[model samples]
Target: MPCIRDLRIPVSTILGQLATGRAAGEILEDFPDLEPDDILAALEYAAAAVQERELPLAAR
Candidate 1:
């Protein structure tokens, strides 16, 4: 799993906080070691991860 530059803070952790309506500032407050750009990078990573790709599915 991707982490914040050796901080051991998984990108998923940041994403989960954002998913629960926590703003970037709030997250930063909670993790004083994190920077605003870290949150942005996590979002970007997620966006890239979900880019168009094929997935197997059962026929209907």
Candidate 2:
């Protein structure tokens, strides 16, 4: 799993927060050590992770 600047904060953790309707500012407030770019990077990393890949689909 990818982490934020070796801080041991997994990208999934950030994504989970975002998925729960938390704003970036709110996340930063909760984790004062995190920077805006870290959140952006986590999003970017997730986006890239799912790109150019194919998944199996069941036939109807």
Candidate 3:
């Protein structure tokens, strides 16, 4: 299984898709190794960022 933390692309991108309406199960259809916990982590990270309104230089 691949590590969600190790995905080369930004987790935020996936998180946004999820937030909009995509399902965790659907995402794993493409990436077989992804887990519910990985989805949860992305959600948590996105929520924290949105709540704090913190925009890092890399994101902007």
Candidate 4:
């Protein structure tokens, strides 16, 4: 799997894909070796990462 080829690509990229409207089915189709759970975990990680950033609305 391409994912296995590079373990350091943070999960944020995956979350970005979803946020930009890439569905799970499409992601899976594009990267066949990724399981459904991997996508879910990436989402969870992204959520946590955002919380950690904790930027105020004023910053945006």
**Candidate with maximal TM-score:** 1
Q: What clash count does candidate 3 reach?
A: 0
Ranking by TM-score: 1, 2, 3, 4
CA displacement after TM-score superposition, residue 55 of candidate 4 (Å): 13
Write one digit per residue (lDDT tens) for candidate 2, span 10-42. Answer: 999999999999999999999899999999999
Q: lDDT winner between 2 and 4, please give it.
A: 2
Question: Per-residue lDDT for 1-60 in model 4, tens only?
Answer: 123225554576677778899999998787777778888888766576568555567754
Collision pairs in model 3: none
The TM-score values for the models, in the order shown, are: 0.85, 0.84, 0.63, 0.62
- Residues forming the 10-long window of minimal summed lDDT in candidate 3: 1-10
Candidate 1 on 1-60: residue-level lDDT in tens?
899888999999999999999999999999999999999999999999989999899899
Residue 17, candidate 2: alpha-carbon lDDT: 100
Candidate 3, residues 1-60, lDDT tens digits: the string is 222587754686676667789887888786776777888887777677679565668755
Residue pairs with colliding backbones in model 4 are none
lDDT of 3 at 48: 72
Cand. 2 Cα-lDDT: 0.95
